[model samples]
Target: MEVAPQLRPRAGLEVVAGDVGEAVPSYAQAFQVVVNIEVKPVATVPRRTPGASEEADRLWLEHARTAAVIDDEGCFLVRGADRDWVRVRRTAHTALSAALVPGAGSMVIAMSPDGRRLCALTEEDDDYWIVVHHFEDPLM
Candidate 1:
């Protein structure tokens, strides 16, 4: 699948820590890649709840340095440090896609204090996987 142009890493930036798994070979790690990355855990909402994605987004706007909204169809709309939002579409079979399915477990949204990174934690079958995206610049 093609990743949104905005989601691509900027020049001089690389995946310094995480393993780019079979999925897309970019920033595809199932676990958090900690490299002196400090984040504030904002909220955890049950995915089974109605409008869970919306709730996540709302919390993100209030607490995140950056935030991403993942729809059930595997579409990602990410807001960077600039407060500008960009979008990407992913295949439906990915772990994130599965976790967004109705009746799935909870999702936790976290962000760096500097507003340069955003982490989304999704639960699947009692297992939680974290996907982190980093921005080249800090929040304006």
Candidate 2:
């Protein structure tokens, strides 16, 4: 789960042009080498309706018809009720209007390595990789 400066509730960080995929690595054409760093990995984000696998998808699709970047350990944050700081992976699916719905049990954002590709960061073979893909696929 990519944590950004915006993930912080009270601190006001300037909007800067950068991406974690770009900030920390030489992206493989396959996006396999990109790292997925956890900021608050201990989070257990509350469920809006008791489902992150499906409802989470609905939330993102309804807003922008894009894939969601789910933190493996996403939970309630100190600030922004139900709000979570998600690292947007680079992808073609961009949210037209982004929203944070803690009541629904989460804070969401559409992001990318370069802010242009749909990505899923996973731990496979004991290593993290930012896998880029279309927004229509599951995190499996």
Candidate number of the best lDDT:
1
TM-score of predicted structure 2: 0.21
Q: What clash pairs does model 1 have? A: none
Off by over 4 Å in 2: 1-35, 38-49, 62-115, 119-140
Candidate 1 global CA lDDT score:
0.38
Q: In candidate 1, residue 66 scores what lDDT?
A: 39
TM-score per model over all chains: 0.31, 0.21
**Cand. 1 TM to true fold:** 0.31
Instruction: Give per-residue CA lDDT, model 1, range 6-122, as digits (tens).
Output: 334321111122222222212222123322245334455555677655555444434332354333433443323342333333332222322243345444333333334556655
Worst 10 residues of 2 by lDDT: 72-81
lDDT accuracy of residue 122 in candidate 2: 30
lDDT (tens digit, per residue) of candidate 2 on 22-113 = 33222232233223333222112224335443443334333222332322322111112232223332223332112232333223333432
Over the full model, what C-alpha lDDT does candidate 2 score relative to the true structure? Answer: 0.29
